[model samples]
Target: MKHPMPALLILLGLAIAPVAAQQVYSWTDANGTKHFSDMPPPPNTASAQRLNVRSGVTTTQAVEEPAAEGEPAAGSGPAMAAAAGYSDADIKRNCAAAQKNLERYEAAKPAEDEEAEVQTRYQEGLSKVQSQIKLFCG
Candidate 1:
């Protein structure tokens, strides 16, 4: 009985091993001081961590204004900024092309009636247009 119990505990430990390894946090206060912690450190901390998993990591500075209105957000990567930035005229032109692609996709109407495929293609083209608009509008 003791042998089986120890084996079962070992298996349970192995199952939970991966999730126990990670931790993160981020916080900023009115005084412009920032704090990051895996867990509450002490009373002197900047603040307690936010509970959400997505924002758990305190990777970057928590600035007041986010990425300047219409500006490419920070950490979006140079490639994205380069790819997304377009002139006003370029955005309009790309948007026009995206619309044309959607129309063509709709008209193509496969024999199998695969609306999903057409929609996916149409959406991809539209996203390109949206990216251009986001950068250029800034």
Candidate 2:
């Protein structure tokens, strides 16, 4: 018979397609920080933002609010404002590393019995990297 492997592979791919595709959400924390994740935010979900992966665009469900303290008033969301004491090259390198860490945290798999702990760690790590990026990379 002709190779059945190709047909089987196609079937497997079809079966896993739905599970592989997921929606990512974004929301601000109590600290006025922005975060992204595959899971929706718990509170204020009505105002949570959705990101379009294919187009790399984000859609906001809530009206724009005032800028946070130390943040630029006119137009500064998540981009870092300054590098502080770090040099330009250092800031760029740190920003890239932080971005990569955030991605890894987002994609990490939780243990079956330690889901909550895993999620907490992920959020904590996300907060750190996001703050780093915001402070030094803009």
Best by lDDT: 2
Those runs of model 2 whose alpha carbons end farther than 4 Å from true positions after fitting are 1-83, 109-113
Write the residue-wise lDDT of candidate 2 on 17-76 in tens digits: 765555777888877778889887987555587665553565564676877886654444
TM of each candidate vs. truth: 0.37, 0.36
lDDT computed for candidate 1: 0.58
For candidate 1, which ten residues in a row score worst on lDDT? 50-59
RMSD, candidate 2, Å:
16.1
For 1-138, candidate 1 gives per-residue lDDT tens digits of 757988999999997765554555566666766766566545655565744344254345456555766665655433244565755566556556656655675576455656788767766766765555444333
Per-candidate Cα lDDT values, in order, are 0.58, 0.68
